[model samples]
Target chain A: MKTLVVDYQAGNLRSVETALRHIGASHEITDDPVRLARAERIIFPGVGDAAHAMRLLAERGIDRVMRERHAAGIPILGICLGCQIVLEATEEGGAACLGLVPGTARRFPSECGKVPHMGWNTVRSREDHWLFRGVPAESSFYFVHSYYPAPESEEDAIAWCDYGIEFAAAVERGSLVATQFHPEKSGEAGLQLLRTFVEAG
Target chain B: MLQKRVIVCLDVRDGKTTKGVRFEGNVDIGDPVEMARACYEQGVDELVFYDITASAEGRGIMIEVVRRVAEQIFIPFCVGGGIATTDDMRAVLLAGAEKVSVNSQAVRNPRIIREGARRFGNQAIVLGMDALADRRMPSGYRVVINGGRVQTDLDALEWAREAERLGAGEIVVNSIDADGTRDGYELEVTRVIATGVGVPVVASGGAGVPGHLVEVFTRGAADAALVASMVHYGEYTVDDIKKVVADAGIPVRRQGARPEAGPV
Candidate 1:
């Protein structure tokens, strides 16, 4: 399958590209809306602030292309800030985001051990979703974010993890699948997740 | 629950991994790219490359090593040493590193932390500190720079808190006294800073055995432990240390381990 990694000039695009290359997936890295619209599968990977990323996406007109692709049922996987902006909005800069999922991203409180939650943590899948294929149970995925997505409905959340509070680690709605943790950086289990994203879908 | 991280540090000088005693008496070891791949395959949670080289040409070589490592290793890794400006951080990240660590340069000018955080986001910035135990300081520890050659008036804990407020996402505490000793971590200093700061604290130096890691996590309260001599010399593997940590009832991300953690 041809995979397109959406670049908004935020996040570790190189890591994502490297992971895809390691998985033997045919992929291209681009911010061009035309190329983004042509990919069979889309990997929306991001880091940094949501407001600035939204501005860059708007400037490139990739936001419209993403929404149209989602409507047409093309699979899109979001990571970190890429996952956060998929919600209706994010508390970071109080910026509006793509309304692909019904929710908002909120920052972790000071009481949650640490704010950024940087390290490895276990993610428990809620169901037998294809995204968890070949992924062992209670596998640890690398996380480095202060804010996490709180989806509006419980049904949309496919996985949950606890730092200070139980928050949505992964969520899915039709062709959309997003993870607050970095699968590309999560090692073997994470590599399995990317493989499932390419083969099963 | 977040598993305590086991990070293998590769001190690079002239594109080759090196080791020293208390940050002195350095000697070349092996290729950094090859060593990084081996550690990744061994299931190390993370990797940190500290460019100990002090020349402009070495910086270019460090970037090249980072690119090659990024292509092979799938886990998260950080690059540090001689990174003085935002441009330096950008160059490293663009070459394919997950995070850029600022050490002695961050002490010389703390604003680089905020500036780099602003341009690249706080999550991309790490504060690497080499602190020594000093009874005269308020926190009982003094900050040192230039690979433990210069001592500063800044308290170690104070510097850590300030760096966090300035937008450093994480703090790495290296004990100048305990480094390269192969003894154990400085539990007092590591504990003090780990509780004082709200960000994740990494304990470095003096890890001779797996039990030292368990001590750092359970007693010192460090979120991660950075190992060099113990693993670099082939005395212990990353999995060996992790197995001991897990056997102690501490949670760790063992590659393809049993699926004991079911649905929440």
Candidate 2:
């Protein structure tokens, strides 16, 4: 299956593409919403500021296409800032987001061990999601952001990690699956997680 | 619990992993990508690749080398040497590197740290500092650049504080005095910077034995330690070093071990 890695001029698309290739999956990195319209699976991988990313996505009309795709039951995976933009809003720029997932991204309080919480940390599985089938609970994934998304409903949370406070590490609802960590840069267990998602298609 | 990290550093010149004493009389070690794979399999937490041949012309080729290494290894790795601007950081990050380290360039243009951190987020940028023992300096250590060929007026402690203020996510502290001596880390200098900086500090250079790792992680107050000679000389594997570190009552995640991490 050909996967569309939506590139709105933000995020680590190259690393995500490398991860997909490592799993023997074919993917196209593009910013065109028209091409994404035919996507079998769309991965909204991101890094950088959520407000700016949302603007870039809107400029290319990709946000609309993404919403349409989600409504059609197509699988979409979001990572870090990609996951944040899917929420209703983010505190980074006091900006509104795609609203695909009902939540808001808030910055981790300075009282947290570290603001960005950079490096490896454990993520706990909240449910038996296909994307984490073989990924053992407590598996450490790479995280590099200060702001984190808090899903409006607890039921949407599939995995969680803590820095200053307990925040959504991975959220799932119907066909949407998102993680705040960079699975592409994560190690062997992370590869297993990518393989599970790629093979699920 | 956040586990202490054991990072293996590879000094690459012309795409070949090389080892040198005090940054001179370098000898080719092996293929960097292959060596990186071997180290990862042995349970290294991270890898830092430094392109020793600081040339703009060779960077294009070095990026390909980084791409190949990223393709082969699953763990996060950092690229340092010759990174001068935000665009240079982008070029390497886009090539699949997880972090970019700036040393000489960061000194010449301190804004590069803020620019890189702003463009790529703080965690993606690392400040590589080469420091030498100096009694004349207020901090008792001076910042050295250009591969230890030139000493600067900047104090090691003060520069580290400035780097953090400008938005560096991590600091890799290398002591030119203890470098390659394998006697151990410069605990005095390392403790000064590690305690002074808000960001995580990685201790680099002068690691000889498992005991040194313990010393740096404990008394040195380092968040992580970068090893080169001890592992490069084939006296120890990444696992052996980690086992030694863990045996000393420090927490470390064994590579590919049970991933179940409980809320501790």
Candidate 3:
């Protein structure tokens, strides 16, 4: 399956691209909206301010194509800031997002340990989902983020991790799957996730 | 829940693994790829490779080493030293490093931290601060750079706050005075920065025994601990340290038989 990793002048595209290559998945790293519209799976991987990332996506007209792809039932995966951009809006810059997922991205509560919960965290499965196909319930995944998405439906959340409080780690709705952690960097368990996503297609 | 991390730091010089006292008097240890694969089989939580020669050589050799290690090890690994620009970070990540640590460069160009975190995501950017306890300094600790050879007037706590503000996802506070001492972690210095910064802090240097790891986690307020000399010279295994931490009531990733509880 061909995977398209969207590049919006933000995020670790090379790492994600290298990871795909590691798994032997044919893929392309592109910022062009036309190319993104043709991939079997679209990955919106980003790192940076949510508002600025959204603006860049809009600038390149890739945002509309992404929404259309989602509507067409193409699987989409967002990591960190990419996950936040899928929300209805973000508190980072009070910017509008894709609204594919009914939620709002806000800075993690200050009292909850720290702003960015860095390092490896054990994710507990909320429900059986394809993303967690070979992943164990006690498996640890690398996480680095300062903000989190508060999804409207708890059912949409497939996995959760706790810092100072329990928060969604992986969210899925049909063909759309998003995780705050970088699967490309999460080790074997992470690679298994990508493999599962590829097989799901 | 966050699992207690067991990190093995590989200090590379001239494309080979090396370690020294207070970042001085380096000695060739072994090959980076050999050491990294060994640590991976031991089930280490993460691997940190620092190019000790980068700042002086103005280039990085760990990129190829990282690529080779990543091919063998499926766990998360971080690469540090001489990361001055986003392009530098991109090159390392493309070569297979999960995270890129910036120390001297971030201190010199604070915007590099912002750009790296912005472009690669905060998780990919780790700020490494080599701090020395200076009684004469106003903040009690001073930030040191260039492998702890150059001392800056900037306060350690102040730099940590700035790193977080600029989008650093984590801070690795290395105590220059206690490095390779085998005494214990500099709790006082680590606590001040940990409490000051809003991101997770990993305490480096001065870990001699299993008890020291406990002290770092409980007393130092450190989320994780980075060890070198102790693990390198076979003082303690990664599993042994995790067992000690777990036996002491701290949560650690357990892989084998737990060790007897040690005195905290």
Candidate 4:
């Protein structure tokens, strides 16, 4: 499958690129909006700040291209910070994001133990989504984030992971699937999730 | 319910993984890529790669290693070393590192922490502080940097608060006194930082037994526990540590395809 790994200066692009290669998928890592626009599937893997990342996207004009890709029915997967940027806005830096998914990204309550809920977390699948094919319910995926997207609809959530409180760990609406955990770093279970995404494409 | 985390740390120098005792007597373990893959097969919850040679070399090679390991394994990996600027953090992240850890650099330039968190989001930035117990200090622990080679006047608690304020998502408190001692974690120091910071605290150093992890979680109030020597030498498996934590009534995510029987 042809996949475009977004390069917005905020993603773990090489790692995401390497993971896609390991999964035997043909992928290109590019900051060029034109290349991204032509891909059959897109993967947005972000690791830096939402505001700065969004600013970089805006500078490159990739944000508009991403909105176009999402509207075109192309399967897109956002990992970690990438998932947060897909929301309407984030409290992290009051950054605006592509409102492809109806949600607002907010910091995990400080009372909820720690700020960034790092390490492995169990995600309970809320619905039958193709991205979760071959993955069992309550499968643990590696997560490293302090902010989680609070989707407007519970039906949009495909999986949930509990930190201080339960929050959306994975979201799916139409052809768009995004995860707060790094599928590239979630071990075999994560590989299954990526394989499902590639197959769906 | 939050599951207890089992972390395996790899100290990398010149592209090889090494482990030492009391921060001395360094010995080469093996290839970092191979060791990391093995840890993944053993179901390690997270992996930490500390570039012990970063500051001295004035550059970071762990990024390439992170790329290699990311290609081979599907597990969260944290990279720490000579990360001093936004460009450095961006380089590592672009190389495939899930989290970039800042230590001496964060101390020297607190803005680096703020800028990193602002650009990468707080979750992708990790502040690694190596602390040493000092009775005369206000917080009773002092922050050490440059791979524990230099001591700073900053108190552990104060530095932790500043790190969190600057948008550090996680804080890994490494006790230089207990590092590689294998007696246990420095609960006193870890507790002070964990209680002071709003971010997740990862207690590193002095992890000799499985129960030490429990002590870190309960007494230290740390969200995750990190170990290197014990797991690297095969003294204890990640699964063993999880069982010990689970048996202690603390929740831990168990390996395999089965779902967690209880509410997560």
Q: Which predicted model would earn the best DockQ?
A: 1
**Cα-lDDT of candidate 4:** 0.82
Cα lDDT tens digits for candidate 2, B37-102: 787777677899998876766788789889998898787899998887798899889888889999
TM-scores for all candidates: the values are 0.95, 0.93, 0.88, 0.87
Candidate 4, residue B154: how far the Cα is off, in Å? 2.7
Give the lDDT of residue B112 in candidate 1: 100
Error of 2 at B255 (Å): 1.8
Model 4 stretches astray by more than 4 angstroms: A49-64, A88-96, B21-24, B54-64, B84-91, B105-121, B145-151, B256-264
Better of 2 and 4 by lDDT: 2
lDDT of 1 by residue, B46-158 (tens): 89999999899999999999999988888889999889999999999988898899998998899999999999888889999999999999999999999899999999999
lDDT by residue for model 4 (B99-143), tens? 899999899899999998877777778999999999988999999
**DockQ-based CAPRI category assigned to the predicted complex of candidate 1:** medium
Quote the B-chain TM-score, candidate 1: 0.94
DockQ of the candidate models in sequence = 0.69, 0.47, 0.41, 0.55
| Best of the two (1, 4) by TM-score | 1
Q: In model 3, which regions exceed 4 Å deviation?
A: B21-25, B54-60, B70-76, B84-90, B104-125, B165-167, B233-235, B254-264
**A75-187: candidate 3 lDDT, tens digit per residue:** 99988888888889988879999988999887878788776776678888765776888776677787877788778899888888888888888887667889988888676
| Leading candidate by TM-score | 1
Candidates 1 and 3, the one with greater lDDT:
1
Off by over 4 Å in 2: B22-24, B54-57, B256-264
How would you class the docking of model 3?
Answer: acceptable
Cand. 1 TM to true fold: 0.95
User: Ranking by lDDT, best first?
Assistant: 1, 2, 4, 3
